[model samples]
Target: MESKGILTKLYSFLYIRGFKVWTSYRTQVALTILSWVLPVFTYYFVGTSLGNSLVERIGVKDYTSFFVIGLAFQGYVSSIITTVSGRIRNEQLYGTIEYYVLSRSGVTSFLFYSAIWGFAVNTINAFIIMSVGLGLGIKYDINWLSSIIISVLLILSTLGLSFLSAAFTMVIKQGNPISLFFSTFTTLLGGVVFPVTAMPIPLTYLSYALPLTWALQGLRGSFLDGEGIVQEGGIILVLLVFNVILIPIGVLAYKYAFRKAREKGTLSEY
Candidate 1:
């Protein structure tokens, strides 16, 4: 099938990138260990201080465990966004993006492969952190079915956001600001470190509108309550709806920007 061929290409791209990242074995392992344990120390102390008072308010039985799962998932989702948006600039500077874009490969194929590479790398990081948490006795819901479904939805939503940022890069010729905006917004409004429901009404509304809000909620649901997936089905549904609408818009915007860039002959300019 044509779809299968595309996926094969995507998978090969991811495999190559992952192999390269893994070649830095010592650094990768050390950083992965730090990622897992350092956060536990920070959140465990904070959560213990809040104790049952905050745990109950946040609708989770164990605040520390809840925080750890949410943080791990947030790390993965945020890393995907960060890498996809920033990779274009890196490749452009390195003289690879122009080659890829102008090659026989379709732009769609190139973008998909780049995103697959990012997703693969970040997924490894997420797994290392989560496995360490489990070794430390952080009980996970382990609903693979729900986790898979939510993961697909999260990737779709995030890929749409990635496209928007790529379009910004294609049009404006830089993506650092777009990356900064999403990173800051995710930390503030994504409910990774704290519950968004605790925020005031206005901020709560704003948080709900952000894509990462839905992502964190779905991830927390998948890993923490297990019931959160079914109970917060509305959020998941909304995210699905958002992907359906935004992905097409993002694609059109990206194509338009790409055409403009080609016309201006600015694709190679840093």
Candidate 2:
């Protein structure tokens, strides 16, 4: 009876959908893992071919480390939108969204919890990419305090954006402007593959407006330039301003949108 009860609890509580797919197709899992590292080499070769001018333009000598940090960190920024919105999207299609919306803890926590695995996968992907960069001679001079501060700010900004995107998804059911904006422009303007300095001065102003751009600048400064939190105080301030403004706006939008959806009886509509 004890063994049967334990097995029943495991079956009830464990989510095996994504895991089952990976287990059934080991090759796909391996390739998906390998794909994360491949970009490090692509960027390295591109950086090498571009030569010293590339490094000089970015004002960072180590091209590998610069792009590596940019790429790894942007995953968290970009993934927050897709993951949270994707959960709501999936629930809508599965017709299980009504249950989530009616749950005591509600749709906000429901979507947040369901989307966590994607962030975990993003974390693993980041670790693998950074490890590959290390193998390719990218060096770090990390200041733990600065990294932690910048990371927390980045996460807060991401959560704010996540809620905003989720709010849009709940209503629109497709092609949210918030998600579209981030998806289309974040890689180009967020300093993921290149410094904002490399862009035209007007575009540089736009880049500075992005939370990812500030976060990456501070993160790279901490990891590569051994910058302390005090050294990156300006970046920290900008991120705090973003958190303060965006978080409340996001929460308000989420509550309003979710309430609108419920009122319209559109919970399961795709």
Candidate 3:
């Protein structure tokens, strides 16, 4: 009961803090919405220009819809890494990280709640982006149940990467190259703008190593092909395996990095 009470307070603190931060930057919020929406027009035009050839190559009936789904999922993936890492860096820069380390609620709890807030905000952003795409006439035959299942798995897999990024932020202090590299790598290789099959053999094999590859395949299967969880069983299994393997490794890495940073007297350094 005491533990549950602690969790409740921690959650309330994180949620209120997130709400305050978002509301304080109304103009930035509007620009962020515009940034997400504006890219769809460029993709829509490019997809239309390519016509049926693009559809045939991608094995999807509508290139615009395919691209839109990929882009939406990319938003979720990017947010997890960038938000977790960036929040830690921001706390360090603001000299509040030491307080986090000393907090009764615990640093890990703070990190986890911050990540949850980021995931919630980005999920809403993805939905808005998809709605805008639909308004632009990007058609989808969505399987809501399957999409939800795939989304949960995607979030779980992504949390592993998020934790890894947080670990790097602890050690590096600033300029998280791992986050940047993963963002670009996933964009190119996770079939965000194009199909992974179009890549060379080596690149195709390499793409399979990233959890986002299976996530995109599962998402596209549900969104574009109307596939269910049963139909996407293989991709789901792969993602499950990734979550099981990566999450523990990521947590241990973060804990080790945090400890090293403290011992080196670098945790509060910026």
Which candidate comes out best when scored by TM-score?
Answer: 3
Q: Which stretches of candidate 3 lie over 4 Å from their true place?
A: 1-14
> How do the residues 170-220 of candidate 3 rate in per-residue lDDT, one tens digit apiece?
998777876897767788988887888989989989988988888888898
Q: How far is candidate 3 from the true structure (C-alpha RMSD, Å)?
A: 1.9
Let me know the TM-score candidate 3 reaches against the reference structure: 0.93
Query: Least lDDT summed over 10 consecutive residues: which range in candidate 3?
Result: 10-19
Model 2 Cα displacement at 30 (Å)?
Answer: 2.7
TM-score of 2: 0.88
lDDT of 2 at 139: 84
lDDT (10s digit) by residue, model 1, range 1-270: 888886777656766565556566878767766865688778777777877876788666766666666666666556666776667667667867777776767665677667776677667667776776677678777666667777778777777777777877766766356566665667667777778887888998998887677766777767766754577678778878978987888788778877888799887667
Show how many residue pairs clash in every candidate, following the order shown: 0, 0, 0
Sort by TM-score, best first: what order?
3, 2, 1
lDDT of each: 0.71, 0.82, 0.83
* TM-scores of all predicted structures: 0.86, 0.88, 0.93
lDDT of 2 by residue, 100-130 (tens): 7676657776655544545666777788888
Show model 2 residue runs off by greater than 4 Å.
Answer: 1-28
> How many clashing residue pairs, candidate 2?
0
